[model samples]
Target chain A: MGCERYRKYVGAFADGELEVKENLEFLEHVKMCPACAARVDEVATMKGVLQRVYAKVEPSESLRQRVAESLGDASADYRHRPRSGWSVQLRRLVVPVAMAAALIFAVVIWPSVDRFRPRPGSVTVVTGRIVSDVRAQHTACLGRSGGTHQAADLPLDVVGISNVLSRELKLRVLAPDLRSLGFRLVGADRCGVRGHSGAHVLYQALKKDAYLSIFTVGRLPEVVTTSNAQIFDVFVSDGGPLAVLGWHSDKASYLVCGDLPKSELLGLADQIRFADADTQDPTEPVFVRRDGD
Target chain B: MGTETGQGNEDARTRFERVAMPHFDVVLRMARVLGTGEAEAEDLVQETFTRAFSAFDRFELRTYGARPWLLRILHNVFYTMRTRAKRRPTLLDDVDFDHFADELDEHASEPVSADSVDWDQFDGEIKTVVAALQPEYRTVLLLWALEGLSYKEIAEICGCALGTVMSRLYRARQLVGRALRNYASQRKLNVERFN
Candidate 1:
C-alpha cells in the first residue's frame, strides 16, 4: 500500500514524460524504495524489448515508391479551383458573406497575404543572425523542458510559475495569448543575441511534440523594412522543423519560431502586432489591434 | 497564373510534402498491421496518402502535426476496407474488456518478484507474445513503444478519449508483462534443470 501510489507513475517515469520537478521528486522516493525502482526497471526493460524486436517491421523501398507514385497520380487537390468564377453579379452578391467568413477565420488563420511571404531582397548579415539566434533559443528551451537535458540546472520556477520578461527585458512585448492555438505559455527567458537585449516567451503545445517561441528583440535587429519585412526562411539542413518567421514594426523586431508546421507558425506571426512604445502600457506587454482589424 | 488561387495550389503541394510526406513510413508500418496482408496494406497506405494529398489544403495543423491526421485517415481507410470485406466484425470490441482489464492488471501489478531473468533469452519469442495480443492492445502498445508518441498523441490517433488510451495502455502493458513473467519463469525452470 505504501508503494502503490508511486507504482502508477513508474510508467511515466520510464517514458520520461514527467516534468523535471516531478522526476526529481520520484527519484528521491525511488532511491529509498526498491519496489518502485524495480518496477521502473521492469517496465523500461520490457518497453525496450518490444521496441527493439518490432522496429524491424518497416516498409520496404517498393512501398515507398508505390505511395509516391500514387500521390503523383492523385487527382487535383483541394486547391484545384475551377477555371471559371461566378458571373460578376454573383461575385458581388457573395463578396460580403465571403468577407464575413474571412473575418471569422481572421481570428486565427491568415489567407497568407502579408503573412510569411519571404523577401530575401536586401538581406543583411544581422537579419540572418537574428534567425539563427531565435532557432538556437527555441532549441535550448526545448532541451531544458525535454526532461533529458538540464533538468537539474533549471530553476524550480522555470515552467510558467514566474515572468521575468517585465523586469528583465523592459520592452513592450506581447507574449500574444496563444492558448487558442493549443499551446500553453510555458515560461519566458531573457536572451542576448548579437548584443541585442532580447526576450522570448516559450509556448509548448498542449500534450504535443512541438514548441513555439515568440522572440522580441530590442531595436529590431537592424532588419530594414521591406514589404512588411516578413521574410520566412527555413534552412532545409535543419531537417525543416526549425521554420522561423521574423517581422519588424517601426521599432522592435519579433521572430516566431517553432517545430510546428509552417502554416501554423505564420498564423501566429499574424497575431504578433506591436504598439508605439510611448503609447503602449510599459508595465504590461501591449497587444495592439492588427491592421484592418 | 500569378493569381491567389494559383499560389494556393502551389503552396498546398509544398506544404503537404513538407508536413505529410515525412510520416510515410510510420503510416505504412501501421497499415501492415491493420490490414490482413502486405500487398493489400501497401495499396491501402498508397490510397490513404493519395486521399491525404487531395485533401491536404483542408487538413489543419493543431496540437499535433500531420502524423496524427495521417494516421486518422489511414485508420478510416482501413476500416472502410475491412467493412467492404466483411471481416471487421471480429474486432473484439464487444468483449468485456473491463473484467479482463482488472484481472490482468491485478496480476501484472504484482510483478513476478523482480525480473531476474535475462530479457535477451526470450527475444526470439517476444514478437510472438506481442502478436498474440488483441488488435486494439497491439496498436496502442506499438504506437507508444515504437513510435514514442505521448498518451495524448496516441489518443488523437486512436480517436478515443485520453482515459480510454490510458486504460487500453494499462491493459496492453499488463498482458505483455504477464507473458514476459511467464517466459522468465520458464527460463528459470530450464536453468534449474541444467544446473
Candidate 2:
C-alpha cells in the first residue's frame, strides 16, 4: 500500500482504534518509514497537549449550582435546595447592589482606613490553616508507628463508621460515600487542628496507594468564602505537595486534602454529607470552644 | 407504593449525579468550543442539562456513561440555537483541505520538537485555529482528539457512520497540523529576521 493509505490509518493507530491486524500492519510500515513515524508521533503528542490544555477549563461553581437548581425536584437530595422565584430575583439584585455598595464604601470610607484595608490573599487565613493542619496530620499520622488501621479494624460502611465516630467524638462527623469513586475508609484517629479537637479520617484508594485525609472541626471563625458559595462557603488551595478542598456551614467546617488534583479533591468534597447537627440534642455539646472568652 | 416511588426517584437522581454530572467540566469545555462566547457557552450548558434532565428517563445507565449522550444534546442545542438565529451551519466543504494537506507536507521534514514549542502560545493558536474550522470538523476533532472519545463513540455522538468520523478526523488533524506548522515557521522566520 502507498503511504497515503497508511497515512489514513495513522490517527486510528494513535487512538488505538485500529483492529489488531491493521495495527500491526501500521506499526510495521512505520518502522521502515521515518516520516510516517514522525507524523504519528506528532499526532499523538498534539492529542496529549490538547487534552492537557483544554481540560484545564473548569466550569464555574455558579454554573454548577445553576444547573443543580434547574434540576428542581429531581435533585432533591442536593444539599442546597433551590430558592424560590422571588428569592432568586432577590439574589440577582443583591449581587449588583452589594457591588454598588462596595464601590461606595471604597470611594467614601477608604482614605481614613488604609490601615484596615484587607491584604490580598489574606482572605484565605482559616482555609490555609485548615489545609496546613490537614497536611500536617496526614504526614504525622502516616509517619507514626501503628498510626493507620485496616478496614477490618473499623466500621467498613461509611454511614456506620460516621455514626460510630460521631458518638465517640461527641461531634457530627461526616463520612462521605467514596466507594463509587474507588476509595475506602481505612481508619480514623483523634486529631486536633490549631488546638481545636476534630476527627481525622483516612481513606485509601482501592487499587492504589493514594491516601486522602478528611479533617472536621466543629468551630472556626468564618474568615472568608471562596469561589463556590452556592452549596456551602468553600475554599480550595494548594498545600505545597497536596491540594485542599474545604467547606463550611454554620455548624461545622470540613476539609478534604490529598496529593490528588484539585478537581479530584473537589469531587470527593462534593460527596461528603455533613450530619445535621441541628437535629442533635443542643446540650450534648458541639465543637470545643477556645479556652476563656 | 409510596416507598417504591421514592426509591425509584432516588435511584434516578443517583444515576444522573454519578453518570451525568461528572462530565460537567468536559461538557462546559465543549460548550465553549461550540458557543460564540462565555455567556453563550453557559446558556448552552444550562439548556443541555435541562434537556438532559428531562430526557434522563430514557438514558440507559447500564449501556453507556453520560458523556457522549450529554455531548449529543449539547451539540443539538448549539446547532438549533444557531439555526434559529439564521446563522449558516459551517460545512466540511467550506475549507480547501487539499491545499492544507500540501502545506502540511511541505513542513513534514522540519519536525518541530515538543520541548521547543511554547505550549501556552501553541494552546492559544490551536484554539483559534479550531474555532475557525467548520463546525462539522471541529466537533469530530474535539471529540476524538481532545475528549479522547473513540471513533465509534464519536460516530455515536455525531450521529454519523464510523467511516465518516475517521475521514473527518483525518482532514481535521491535517488542517490543524498545517496551521500549527505555518504558525511555527512564521515565528521562526520573524525571529531570524529580527536577529
Candidate 3:
C-alpha cells in the first residue's frame, strides 16, 4: 500500500482489528519498514505514557465546589428568573422610556473607541526557557567566532540571508519557499554567513529546526556554468554531511537545506528556477558556491 | 417480589452511600487518571452520583452491578466535557519517546534480563508510568485499568468507535512499557551518578 493508504491502516493495526491475513501482510511490511515500526511503537508508548501522566490529576477542592455550586446556581436561576420573552418586553419598554427621557438631557458625546474597523492580526511572541537556552547557545557560538559571526538561532534572520544574497548575486531571491512547504516565518538576524567574509543573512521556521542561511558576496568570483545549465539551474548535490540544493536563475541564486538526497534537492531547485524565472528580480546577485573559490 | 424490590431499592441506596461514598477518594484518584483534575474530578464524581442515582431505577442489581454502572457514568461525563471544547494539551507535551533511541549511544551496553526484573517493582512502576500519560490517553486507560471496563463498555462510555478505544488501550499499554523502560534507565543513571 502507498504511505497514506498505510497510514489509515496504522490505526486499525494498532487496534488489532485487521484480519489474520491482513495482519500478517501488514506485519510483513512493518518488518521491512523501520520508520513505520518506530511510529507504531511511539504511538503505543505515547498512549500509555499519557494515561500514567494524568492518572493522579485531581481538580482542586475549590474548583470542585465552584463547579457544583455553579450547577446549583444555574438551576436556581432558571427556576426563579422569568424566561426570555417576558424579560425582553420589560427591557424594551423600560429602556425606551429611560432613553427617551434621557435624550433631552443627554449631551452629544463622541465615542472614544473606533467602531466597524477591521482588526489587525495580533502578533504573539512566545518566549520560553527552551528558546532562551537556544539564544544562549547562539551567543556562545558567536563568542567562539570572536563576535565576527553573530551566531543566532532565529529563523527569520536566516530567511533574510536570501535578501543579502540576492543583493550580492544581483538577482531576485526569496528565502523560505512558503508555497512549497507550509513553513511559518520566525525572527531573522545578521550572522557570519559560513564562508563569506561579510555577514550572512539568516531566516528560520517558526516551529521546526529547518533554517535558510545564505552568504551574500558581491558577484560570483568566476562565471562558471556547465553547458546544460542556463541562467537558472537547480541541482541537488551532496553537501558533505548535509544534503544541499542550489538553484540559479538569471536574477539570483537559491540554496535549500536539509539532509535530503542530492537528487531530490537538485530536482526541486531546477523545478523552482524554471517555474519562477520571470517573476524574480534580475539585479539580485546570484549565490556563489563556497567551494568554487 | 414487589416487597423484595422495595427492599432492594433501600439496600441499594444504603450500599451506595456506604460502599460508593468511601470509594470517593479512590474514585477521585481514578477520575484524575481519566483526565479531570482535582476539582473537575470531584464534579465528575458528583455528576456520576447524580446520574447513577437518577438512573438507579433502570439499574438491575442482578445484571452488570453498580461499579461498572458508576464508572460508565464517570467516563460518559468525562468524554462529554472533553468533546465540548478543545482540550489543552496536558503537562506531558513535547515529551517525545523517540529520543530514547539516542540513549543506545551511551556506554554500559549491558542488556537487562527478564529474570533480573522484579514483578512487584515492575508492576508498581507500570501503574505510576500509566498514571503519567497525557490526560487524553490516561482517561481511556484509567477506565480500562482501574475500573476494569471491557473495551466495548469503554468505547460506549468514551463515545468513541470501539476500534479507537481498543487502539487507545493498546497504545496506552505500549506507553506504559516505554515509561517502565525510561524509569529503569533513569534509575540506572541515578545510581551511576551517585557512584
Question: Which candidate has the top score in TM-score?
Answer: 2
- Give the clashing residue pairs of candidate 2, or none: none
TM-score of 2: 0.53
The i-RMS of every model, in angstroms, reads 10.3, 11.7, 20.5
**Regarding TM-score, does 1 or 3 come out ahead?**
1
What tens-digit string does per-residue lDDT give for candidate 2 at A145-214? 2234223334555444544444343333445545544556766655554444555666655554455577
- Please give the range of 10 consecutive residues that has the lowest summed lDDT in model 2 chain A: A120-129
Best by lDDT: 2
Of 1 and 2, the candidate ranking higher by lDDT: 2
Model 1 residue runs over 4 Å out of place are: A5-9, A16-32, A56-59, A77-293, B1-11, B89-121, B189-195
| Candidate 1: tens digits of C-alpha lDDT, residues A153-207 | 2122321111222223322232344553455665555554445445566655554
Model 1 / residue A261 / CA error / Å: 27
- Chain B of model 2: TM-score? 0.81
Q: Give the CAPRI rating of model 1.
A: acceptable
lDDT of 2 by residue, B1-195 (tens): 346446766776766776678778888999988888999999998889878876877763223356778888998898889999999785655333233333336455355544356657877888899999888888998887666566766887888888778778877887787787788777763221000
Each candidate: what lDDT? 0.56, 0.60, 0.45
TM-score of chain A by itself in each prediction: 0.34, 0.33, 0.30
